[model samples]
Target: MSGRVMPGHTSDLLTLQDAGALWAGLTADSAVPTASTILISSLGSAQMSYALLGSHVVMAVKAHDGRWSISESEVRRAAVGLRAVKVDPQDLVRIGPFGGMPKGEHSEAVLLGWRRRIVGELQRPDPPEQVVPDGDDRALHLAGIDWRRILTEQSRDRTRQTWWLPRAVVRLLDAAEHVERRWLQAGQKESKAAEGIRPRSPRSQTHTTENLQVTKPDHLAASLRPYNEELKGLLYSVLSRKPDTSRKVTGWICTLCRKVPATVLDHCHEHGYVRAPLCQSCNAQERPDHLYPNDIRVTDRYTRLLTTHATEWLRHWHRCPGCRTRTTLPLSHLAAWTAYVACRPLRPTHRDNHSSRGRKPCGTLRVAWTGSHHTPHTCQLTVTIDLCPSGEHRDLAKVPYRQATEQFRIWLAKTAPTVAAAAGPDRLDDLPAQFRPVIPDKSDKGLGLF
Candidate 1:
């Protein structure tokens, strides 16, 4: 069915069925549950945020206007009326964000087809990631000294100040050569002094001026590499904690940004290769050797928000139809979507008698032992079996157990891949691909959106 625009909200539209379902749901559950979506604003932008059930807004999934204005409060406030509608937990059509029902070609076949395809994809396991070595292996403790400071101070001490001076002298009995003539050259021989006046030899006259030749410092005689190792150890001791048995000790916490754990042992290439444990952000950048604080508050906030949103989404979508076991669901987006579709009630025309009658599903197949013969030469046992969807497909029940089992096996093969691909015990990978995690990227300093 084509979408029909709502009278007041002309920009958005919904099909007749979706509109009706929404109206029913809103009117049915008017009391706000903690999981209900809410309108929040920052800097004139309007966003819709969904929180987790039974929890405050620790996590959230958000949808926002592409543009904004100073009147964003008014825009968000207008949507406050829309908040009266809480999601119908049992409605399969009520998927995705509020008001995000599928639009055209709402055929049962199409829905089922999409569901099967998504389920198959979900079952496939994600490939493992390769870890590149980024940090130093040196172990550190608290009792280390700042060897760097001592080394610089020693270099400064090796420098000293020096100077040179020139002196004049005269020898007696050496007559002045035509110089004294300017003054009266009296017959009394100008005895300069007891020693005659004489010029000092050039070699003896000159003294060394300030020595400008470059010289290396003596303390630097020892390479600071050993000290750097010790410093690395000390930093690790102060900054990083020992990981639990299951977790490995990577490196220390980032000396630069306190937000992320240090993955690499970083050094100032400009200086004497001084090293410290640092996260990818500091190590990857063209920055100074010293650690500078990284402003990760924004990342931290958004992370909590997105995590809440995605998690609740999964819980809502993956709940089992019969038992409603949401906690056991695979946390993959594909799995969640598939589970939702599989739980959807089939149309009346498509449902079998058993399903229409609301009979709780027992074992899909029933087996009856026919007889057993205990002859010496031959002993044989036979059994009758029944498969489900009772009436029209009752012929399937008459098939031999072996054949029926084989058919069931085939169905398992088709469905197993997606179901088995669910989130593993360590849910680090449980977060959806849309999120840009802080630890994964070196350049993810700014707030990221999903």
Candidate 2:
């Protein structure tokens, strides 16, 4: 249903159902969680903040980047007054921040079930996330290191960061060109000044690149490709730990950020090219080098960067849905207006990004599974006709698993030849495409979302 404009807030509109749910949630719970979509400015820089009503406001899906301001009222009159005169969800802030409902289309019962879940959670709040797990004792510990927060998505509660690879706990597999630049420049300085201290390299997992070597806490140790093998395995363990979560080793800095503890082992997925240690944020935005062919556009920096690959691995892994003859999603996203219709269930998640496109989302990510979270999953959904983000007809829903894979195969056959024809057979710079990694039989269970 189309939204009806609320009387007081000129910029905001509330759909009838959303208003009803907000009213019900507030009246019953005696509190309503703040919408991260709504924001108020302040002088302070705290990430977890709360503030009073202000004219300058916006909404969003905040990672650990912003503070949360949940408003609560003592007067019983405020709740009854809201029912008489409509109020937007933002008015109820002061209790806690909420990321809205579970995604995907569901029957009314599912909505009811989640509402109940919300009530149960509010009645008895979740325990503090800082409790240390067993077997985590260390002679030396990094102060303020919360393994649970580091391993999980600190952005929004729902972003779901950790995934399981065959041999690693993969929180992220992304790029950090800017950070890398800063790191390399710093290494050059370290190399020049510390020439007197040069010695044989302490053994590392990946090959250590720089000539100068030093002991713990040196910025170059974590940045170098080869790392100490024994520490490397222990280093990798921090990302994968769920129940027995442990704090990071002392002086192991993130290779990318140069600040914060390194939790992820940033390795190449296809080649198993183990890179250096990275904090969660530093590696969140890089396209894995193995995804595409090195081309003319890349040779000359005129073409747009491969930012999309770092954002959505599955989209590139399975290949983008069709947009007539094209695969680039921007082409598909634009094509949606003319060639596709929006699905009600696939509506974008709400956020007030101070723009008209606040409700926009790229596409949903899905994984097909057979047993439970404990068991391995197998499937063949390679591609689909959903070239546009608005098109909900993914490979899984539109075609049989085998047929979808075949269609993908056919597309690859046609596309690869076309690319080769353009590049010419003699071109030496182009790299072969990297296939998705193989899953091992006894791998750690990834997040259910993965």
Candidate 3:
């Protein structure tokens, strides 16, 4: 005999773990909980009305010996109290009907009404013929008594007093109301005036006409004309002049013939044209005569010779192809060579001895004098053929004498003006003819003479 299942008993049974698992699987098909009422039997009582509310089971049950109990927690968990309380719209009533004063549209109206009532009551005199009761009934329980006295008594002890309007107060009140009405009228007038005026939109024609009046391109070009002319003048000045004056010759010599101002260009066989200028006679001639690749031997020999002279003499003197003489020496070259020879072994001691004696080296020997004409007269001539330094004795190939002569003259003119003058006026004029003019014409083209 299986026990009959009560109406909402299924939820109660679900509180058991096994029954809950079964019920959850079954209820998964429904979104809303199944609604049903049930009867529960508990504590030896019967017909208990129960409901399933969300996750809890709520019930009205009978206890042992016929007592009823309602579970508050269970009822709350079931959401029974969640329904909103409602009053019928037809039953709505105003506070005035229930003893409150009639509502006014503004606070001033309400205040004015209260003030009138209080003033009227205060102005009324007490009835003279009325019987006077001297007990609590007359003082506290008098019928139709004035409440204003009571109000005044209560207000007398208060920190703040309530204001009562007399004739003066009524004047102030009238003034305030007049000011308020005037302000409201002024605000309404301003609002109406603002609504009457309209904002104007920008005119397209005016904007387009203004844009068209912009300055013309020709005016802008005219503004820049002065700057362009100035730039042009600067460029002409820079480009018209020769870039380097060192390439200009003031004299010439023929290295191969050992002659100054030789008629033939080939006599100076060691010189060669280098860029817009020419190379030193020795450098030009020896460059092509290298016995080793890249002219390394010749370059090394020249570098050593230049170093031996302390790089000073090489700056002013060039080797001659014909006599093998180092000629066209500048005035500074004399001091430089002297310093070089003095630095050599045994030379300084010889110079010191001569200086001490107040005499020069013997006349048979010739010592190079690079000073003024008076220099050679003051010094004794002495000749000494010492072996050149090992590093400076290498052989060099011969260069074109014409090119070498031209280069040497140019070098002399720029760096050794005194030596060039001493060589004679005609000697200075004997430089390559091409260098005498500003620009080479058709006849002077491609000769490699700048």
Candidate 4:
């Protein structure tokens, strides 16, 4: 069967019986058909279906029946009316804007009412004025015409401007009018020239380059290798305990500065090197020596010192004794070192910075058991060794448990007396809630005396 009709061909006629026969044949073999051909049959069926099912069934059936003749002229007339309907109704509607349809059917009623009113208005008045008003002279001049003359000529041709004019005829008339206008304009120019007045030429046109070339700097730093290698090497030398004598090393240095201690011999031991080679003072103060290779320590002594004195031990690097070189370390190094020490297994709780059981040192040993506890229990012990304020527990490892406990008692006694003197008798009872000292009565004598 034929496909849908092309838009302009919508008014073509065909019989429903022929359309149905065509569709049955087309669909029989699952074959594709041309759009135009298929549409002929499709539209025929649609018209028949609409007739069978529409609200005004009897009228639809009569319209679709071939027995009822539908003239081409009548169809053409209907189509022309539809086209005219699309134009603004002000020209056809004689009524003022205020005279419109009632609320519910405003759109359709307004249009119908306007057409009727226009016919009435036209009959009552003299043929509508076609002359351009004097005020519209400037408008006509801007449009490249003499408005008054054009209006006078158009008024004479008003009878020719019929609603029944075909679109093709309208276009032809428009083209002819345009040519006539041009002829008139040329005549005007010639008259001006005859009077020795030259017409102005159109404005000169100019074009400029849209894209301008940009030049970039010739020398720009490309890679970080040159800037970071020295510091990275220094850090590796210190952490790995290997002297930086131009010897090959293997391990990951701090990715930022590419530095690790010498102690980290190769990649195999790289994971253990926590602190970057640059010291805290260097990172904080931004001094060159902070990146120097020789200034950093490779021995475990540095770690022990840090563990003991913490940040205080780091402050000492601000001045070097060996050459009195004002040493500076990276702040990152201090932070990294603290983190490493916290994670190390040297504390009594067997916890590190990564674990909740770890304690921040407060000038006292805080211990807890991992095993289950039964009755209330307490134990007495002693510790004795040199200790730095850095909280590094190095001395505790060296002294026996009993001796360490005894020294701790003695130290607490001497300090408590001074503290009590300053804070009053309540100072003795104000020990940390987490722990209780079990010193003999002799040690107690120093408690409240102040």
In TM-score terms, which candidate is top?
2
Q: Residue-wise lDDT of candidate 4 within 1-450, one digit each (tens)?
A: 001122123254334444323333432332111111111111122222111000001011124234321223222332232233222211110111122222222111111122123223323334466665543322212111121221211121344321122222222222222222222333344445534754333211000000111111111112112223333212222433445422322122212223221211211011111222221112212221111221221223334344544333342232221101112122223222322332234433323576676754323322211111111122221121223345555423222223333442343235333322232223233223332221111101211100
Candidate 2 ranges beyond 4 A from true positions: 1-141, 144-359, 362-450
Q: Whose lDDT is higher: candidate 1's or candidate 3's?
A: 3
- TM-scores for every candidate against the unseen true structure: 0.15, 0.23, 0.14, 0.13
RMSD each, Å: 37.9, 21.1, 52.2, 39.9
Please give the TM-score that candidate 1 achieves against the real structure. Answer: 0.15
**What would the per-residue lDDT of candidate 1 be over residues 79-165, giving only the tens digit for each residue?**
233243243322111001112222231111111212122222223344578343342101110001111111111111245211110
- Assess each prediction's global lDDT (C-alpha) against the native: 0.23, 0.27, 0.27, 0.24
The alpha-carbon lDDT assigned to residue 172 of candidate 4 equals 21
Tens digits of lDDT, candidate 2, 127-197: 68955555331101111011122121122235532221110111111111222223334445554544656
Indicate whether candidate 3 or candidate 4 has the larger TM-score. 3
The 10 consecutive residues of candidate 1 with the worst lDDT sum are 165-174
Q: Which stretches of candidate 4 lie over 4 Å from their true place?
A: 1-255, 258-344, 349-394, 399-450
